[model samples]
Target chain A: MEENKKKSPYKNKAEKDALFEKEFMHLITPLYNFAYRLTFNEDDANDLVQETYLKAYRFFDSYEKGTNAKAWLFRILKNSFINEYRKNVKQPGKVDYQEVESYYNSDDIDEPITQDLRVDSVKDLIGDEVANALNSLDVDFRTIIILCDLEEFTYEEIAKILDIPIGTVRSRLHRARNILKEKLREYARNMGYNG
Target chain B: MIKTITHLIHRLIGKKEHSYCCKNCINDLYLVLDGEAEQKQEEELLKHIEKCEPCFTRYQIEKSVKEVIKYKIQHKQVPPQLIHSIKEKINGII
Candidate 1:
């Protein structure tokens, strides 16, 4: 009986279904958004979210109740995106972020020049332009922004999700926001706005 | 009185101009904005932000940027068809 109990996380199929729906189902929309932002393609986002759910369900027994279901789901989707889906998307090929990380790490002054824009200007910016500015950042920077700002994850949660230290999460996020500000400033310049 | 004035003049001519370091302020300001910094540290930075000019401007810009990102970014919803398909796949596994 003990062996059987260990094998089955839930007493029955009904309990499993109830737990899964109660804990995980409501997160489908936010999960889809995370997937969509990462892929920037609707069809691929659908496929990624589907794959994420299938894997989540398969591994449900391992997940503890009343825990961070959203972070767990996001971790699965992120892993799948890196391991499987990214290959399918056309790209110049894999750019090792290790080099990028190292370069950024080596400098104490890693913050990009993101100043000079008036706070009033930031408020005046439209949604699409802001989105484009965010989307234009490197994927590493972009992913951190989505997780930190968009998802509103804590530094500790983000560290666990990305498998990096809390310090790295803070530093990377700092650089990402600076880069985004720089991107927006350049956009304004292109539009003939006097910065 | 003369000694106090001499110390003041020395401090004024010292390697550091003011006690608040803008470089350190910029770094710590990120922590303060994240709402995760230590309470004591947060209070200190808050006091400093209230005083420093460049740091105050910097804080306002960073805070505004965060606000814009939170509310201004366009959010796309999950497609109804995708939800249906995800449910179908989940059922298939069981």
Candidate 2:
């Protein structure tokens, strides 16, 4: 993305449309999902996604053609969330990641969390059971899980998307998944699955 | 340290479930799971898990966690109005 910013814009309107449709337009679903996960409100998600598209279109010059448009747009939406919507977010209890990063960084790694969670238990988890577990996480953790697990971005891409080091990406992902698994285990137990 | 305290707490809170995952394999578990392990490390992990039940189960549970999230947390239907609005807005810009 940093490299793309230095390259020239699309050659002409037709070239612009072709790239936009091929790359940018095809990604709206995942973009909307990403937006919705970040915002947790349909109206706000719609507005954020629309605003991202508009901004991406307006600054289409900064985006070199045929690049990782997904990461580019995700970075834009993530920034927009932090800048524009973060202040307005009424959902309390989200912690900024400075504390999380420091706390997670210090750990030399203990046993993995959720030692009791089993394969059968995980299989029994379906739909909202899993969704709620993810939603309940801190936004930073939730974002990493979505990026690494759902979106399947490589660690390098995730680092670019989040603007953190690759090592940080790995540790953050490790911690995030551990927390997620712990939640799923708790939920499964509550649902009466012994495994 | 914090790790010891966590271990102590887990011991007190519940009976210790047998851990198939040891500390060493735990590192490989994630590196392998995330597809970030080097080719040699990945090969070692594959060979190790075959002989190790705990690490194998640990790997499966972690993989399933990712699978569940990807499958279950759905992408909402993009409101047609939102798509239409974005297109119209872009057209106006062009």
Give the whole-model CA lDDT for all candidates, comma-separated: 0.78, 0.80
Cα lDDT tens digits for candidate 2, A44-150: 89999998998898788767656688989998899899888887767566576878867766663654457678888899988988989999888889999999888
Task: Give the residue spans of candidate 2 off by over 4 A.
Answer: A1-15, A90-94, A104-108, B1-24
lDDT digits (tens) for residues A54-104 of candidate 1: 899888878876568999999898899988876775777656677777766
Off by over 4 Å in 1: A1-7, A88-93, A105-107, A110-112, A191-195, B1-20
Q: Could you tell me the lDDT of residue A106 within candidate 1?
A: 72
lDDT string for model 1 (B2-61, tens) is 433544676788732322244677778887777777898888888876756556777888
Clashes of 1: 0
TM-score of 2: 0.85
The native-contact fractions of the candidates, in order shown, are 0.64, 0.73
